[model samples]
Target: MKATWNGVTLAESDDTVVVEGNHYFPESSLKREYVSFSNHRTSCAWKGQAHYYSLFVNGEMNPDAVWYYPEPSEAAAQIKGRVAFWKGVKVEE
Candidate 1:
């Protein structure tokens, strides 16, 4: 699978895990230079707190477009450290 925004592929990997209809891509798939920490955060009953990331591509910024569970709830612990993107970002197989 791949994560793309503004025609830039920020992450790509064959080892993505799908949980609750979201594709949790591995951190290794991401292009580190294009992603930065975001102030945004949200909680899911099963997943726990999700940290966000803003994606920068060729000077364009997409805030809170990527999110992950730094420390997941026991129910979602398998996806800990994995990332998922949304808010106009595309994740495709």
Candidate 2:
């Protein structure tokens, strides 16, 4: 899968974990130059706390458009530190 926004590829990986229809790109596959942590968070009863990231690319800023499970619950352990995109970011094959 490829995660893209603002005409930039944020991450691409052959191996992805899908939960709730969101493809979680491996943390290692992220393009760090275009990514940074955001002071945003959310909780999922089964997935644990989610940390957010801002994607900056081509003079565009997508705030908290990416999220990951830094310390996922047991049921969501597979996505620990893996990222997923939303808010107009595209994830496609």
Where model 2 places Cα greater than 4 Å from the true spot, the runs are: none
**For candidate 2, lDDT tens digit of each residue in 1-93?**
999998999899999999999999999999999987799999999999999999889998889999998889998999987999999999999
Q: Stretches of candidate 1 above 4 Å error?
A: none
Candidate 2 RMSD to the real structure: 0.7
**Residue pairs clashing, model 1:** none
Backbone clash pairs for candidate 2 read none
lDDT of 1 by residue, 24-85 (tens): 98887889998988989999988899999998898899999999999999999888878999
Pick by lDDT: which candidate is best? 2
